[model samples]
Target: MRNPISGAISTLAARPLVRSALTVVTALSAVLFADALLSAPPAAAQQGFGNFFSYQAPKPRRTAKKKRQVDPAATQRAEPGKAGEAKKAEKSGPTQPVSIIVSLGDQHASIYDANGFVTRTRVSSGQAGHRTPSGVFSIIGKSRWHRSNIYSGAPMPYMQRITWSGVALHAGVVPGYPASHGCIRLPAGFAPQLFGMTRMGARVVVSPSDVQPVEFSHPLLPTPKMQEVQVPQETATQTAQQASVELASADVSPDKTAATETKLLNPIAFASVLKKRAVAEKAAASAAEKAALQAAQTAGAEARQATTDLDKAEANLKAAEAKAADPAPVPSAKVQPASQAPTDTGATPSPEEVAAQAEVAQAKAALEQARATKAEKSAAAFAAVEAYKLAAARAEEAGNLIDEAERRSEQVSVLISRKEGRIFIRQAWKPVWEAPITIRDPERPIGTHIYSAVEPSADGSKMRWTAITMPAAKASTSSSRDRKKSKTAEASQAAVAPPETASGALDRIELPDDARQRISELLWTGGSLIVTDEPRSPEMSENATDFIVLTR
Candidate 1:
């Protein structure tokens, strides 16, 4: 026995339309409670009418866990393993200079904070004709809400642009398969988290496989110079020997001061050679250009002469044709004398008239010869013009090479090879010296590393360098289980420590005394240092220094 008013209210709530309206409102409220990637609100905040209608998707065997749903009415729950990861993330705190690694083979992506690995998740990359380009890149642009300009304005939520030509990572429906048109499709839930963790200039390395950093030790690691040994002398003979030395008559050694002076002057001498070479190249290019131009002019003159000849031939052919059609009258005996009896004026053509026909035939033959000559001359003219263009192109190339070589000669540069793992220095196009250097993790992929020494004080001592590390496709990610027990304990300390930067004094390099002294002496400002996995190219070594090499 319920009250009539209560019964009426219950009836209204049971209606489909009323329930649907309430569900929409309930879902909107749930969204308001959860906005961050790593956080969630209280359960009480989400207690609403939306749960009355639960929608579940068909689950795959391997992925028995629920898929991320875009349904607004659904309760946004974190994955089972996510809580532990979130706790780990909280302990690590925010990462600076973040880096992301995407693997095509695994269909996965990982985030590396300034400290170390943060999180990893699955992703869907390009499909079919739109294969994702694998390389090292930086996030150049961001859009919280964006639409594809190239794809019928399809919505791309939390878009992070990596390239100018429409390649990006964005929130979209991932069907556990390659399906996007070139862009990387991220999980609807994970995209928001990643978007929060990254900013412009954050590195994004896409590879065919997973790659991780490993610990490495080499001769380059900073270590104190070895100390000289001494033995205690207990005898007077030993003491006397140490105190005095016998002077030998043949103690004279060749003086190297002049050779050193000459070696120093070699740069000036080479500069003159380079200058002369440039002048000679310029002269050769000019000569080639002039020759081509002269040939073209000669061709043009020949062509003009041929054209005039053709015109004259055409006129001669016309005249011959007219004469053949109606020949000139020959003087007849009828005009000379009426008494000489009737002379035939109109009769079969005589031998002289036949000769006129032969002359007409000869004129036609000459006209045809002229036309053939004109065609040959026209072809020659076209060839000459092409030759001129080729010569001009050669001239321009020569000039550009000259300028580039001169500039490179003046600039200080370095070549680093992963194969050798050594740094080679060049100043004014001459090899100054070389030294061994250790990569932090030599076992893992070091990639191509470039360090550009920017804005230096007159001396190279007080200078800064910018670094870019692009790992190769074959690089691999190291496992934490592989690290030693002691290293694992140190990980916590390393996480809290500041990172080693590319610029400033490198405390890592352990050098021989002579090598260390040599490094200090050579810092003439405005130079660059390049390191790569690939060996230096012959052309580059011959002409000028080439920067960046991440291949093979």
Candidate 2:
């Protein structure tokens, strides 16, 4: 209020200072309001995203458990109770040791037991041409009633069947030799006892010879003087004394006694005996010499006859060879030209008629050309026939060689039968108990047998590793089971880890390639994936994983 200019300057300064202070306070208040707004909870957080921004600590995770695997070998073993039952069944029977001997030579059967020989009976064997085989056999089965198809309504008595086929030993009239059509015929009366003595699975040996005779060469004839020796008769008391003496001397060598006896014999009588023997020997030698000479003459005559027959045979062979080598040649006819001049001199043709005749000649020339063409075709057909015959002969020769090779490589089939858990091997349809182990395939079908080398699966769960599709009619119950088992095994093998390579996997499997190809051809008429060399899509390529390649 003192000076106006100074007051105004002071006022301006004061006003500026006040304005600056007010700005500071307003900026501070705005900053405080912004902080409060940022601190408030989000609306989205209340709707279940609270943990998205929040930092709550995570709870510990629970551990997972692993599954256990089952053992296959332990599962395959038979149960204990069943095994005990099987053992008990095996021990419950009183086994009878019965035997039957059939002689192929006599065509008869003889039954025997521990007691002694049961009975001897007549029998009929195979036949004249189909002779019953000579070998050891065992009774495979027994039946009360049996009949023969080949024989006229003949009822087999005490029918003890030996083979699976109709072959058996039963009551009938024994032909004394091979007469029946493979059945061993027995005498009607002895049938009951024979049947009673034999068991279902008794051993039967049908051999060529039952008893073999001992043989020795005859000694030289005794001398007449040695044969004539006689001792004087003695009283019983004296004989007893002599016998005692002989018994005491019996310990001495027999050679010494023989020498003494020869010495005691009269030399004159011995000489006479030797002379007679020499005469007889001379006569015998002379007769043998004459007989030998006659035999030589007869042999010479036979040789001459044989030579004549051989010459005739050679002539016949030569004729046949010539016929085979050179076939008869066909005769051909020659064509002759028609006569130019007419035989009828009175008839003369006009110009028009002569023109017509000329045209006819031209037509005949054309027909001759056609005939030549036909002749050429006939010749070609004949040549084709000759070629076919030659080819057929070659094919026949190849077939014969194949047949001979197969015959040479023929092996006997080893059949195995498993009844009540026991195994048996058979050769030539006859059972062999002591058969070689190498010939037997333990993993083959339980009832059937085979001789070929059958390669089982690598794991041995299936009988054959390779797939063999047999005809439906020929399939047995066991074979059907085997096929099912093979399929299951194949599925199991497929379930295993995929093979290292596609080809390697194919090798482990069996597929009918030919049949599959045929089916593919039928479905895709024009072509197939196997035949085409085109690239496939991923889906199409996946099909290769399932494809299998089988080799013979």
Model 1, TM vs. native: 0.32
Cα lDDT computed for each candidate against the true fold: 0.56, 0.38
Clashes per prediction?
5, 2
RMSD of each: 23.3, 40.8
Question: In model 2, what lDDT does residue 283 have?
Answer: 56
- Alpha-carbon shift of residue 375 in model 1 (angstroms): 74
Per-residue C-alpha lDDT of model 2 across residues 199-225, encoded as one tens digit per residue: 544556554433211111111101111
Q: Provide the TM-score for each candidate, comma-separated.
A: 0.32, 0.23
Q: Compared with the true structure, what per-residue lDDT tens digits does model 1 show for residues 502-540?
A: 331133333456654443343322344544555654323
**Which residues of candidate 1, in runs, are more than 4 Å off?**
1-85, 90-93, 215-552
